[model samples]
Target: MIVYILNVIIMALGLYCLIAKRHIIKKIIGMVLIEYSMNLFLILIGYRINGLAPILLPEMNRVQFSQYGVDPLPQALVLTSIVIGLGTLALMAAYAMKLYEKYRTFDMSEIRRLRG
Candidate 1:
């Protein structure tokens, strides 16, 4: 619904920042934004109105649980993606720091020009 559209808009803004920004830090921020929006989208996909957690209890019938439970797969996937994204973000920050140490600037264009 509208939430999906908003998610797409956020992702587009991240793409714009990644493509149009000159600063390395800004690009890293953009990457993180895109990662977060994707995680949100995955969570939204598994959401259900009036849904309960996908847990089974002695009183709950199998049919009712199947009909009412929100999906757990997407949630698991998002969790995995978050961990992977954190690792990627850390690697990117390390590279940025090294670039700054060498070039004295976070501007990507300047870094390219200074390459020897």
Candidate 2:
């Protein structure tokens, strides 16, 4: 419950940053926060209280394992997502550096402001 609330709060803050901030780096940070929050939510949704791992041993009853075991799919999905997110963040950071080199500023508004 508390974890869910914290995830929501973090997501909200990230959204706020993405919507209200002008800096490219800040927007990237916001995107990271949102991604992390979503990953956490997925993991939490698949979690069971007092649950054991989904691994099956030869001695364990299949029915009992099915009933008490935790879901492993979400965990796998989150791991993939984290890897993708890291690659995306690295790409975004590289773009930011390129943008800074061309524009001499990190502020998105200032870099793209209308010239009149």
* Root-mean-square deviation of Cα positions for candidate 2 versus the true structure, in angstroms: 2.4
The residue-by-residue lDDT of candidate 1 on 6-66, one tens digit each, is 9999999999999999999899999999999999999999999999898799998899889
Which of the numbered candidates is closest to the native, going by highest lDDT?
Answer: 1
For each candidate, what TM-score against the reference? Answer: 0.91, 0.86
Candidate 2: stretches off by over 4 Å: 57-62, 113-116
**CA shift of 81, model 1, Å:** 0.6
> Model 2 misses residue 44 by how many Å?
0.5
Q: On a 0 to 1 TM-score scale, where does candidate 2 land against the true structure?
A: 0.86
User: Candidate 1: which pairs clash?
Assistant: none
Candidate 2 per-residue C-alpha lDDT over 35-112 given as tens digits, one digit per residue, 9 for 90 to 100: 999999998899898887878888998888888898899999899999999999999999999989877999887787
Q: What C-alpha lDDT do the candidate models reach, one value each?
A: 0.93, 0.92
> lDDT of candidate 1?
0.93
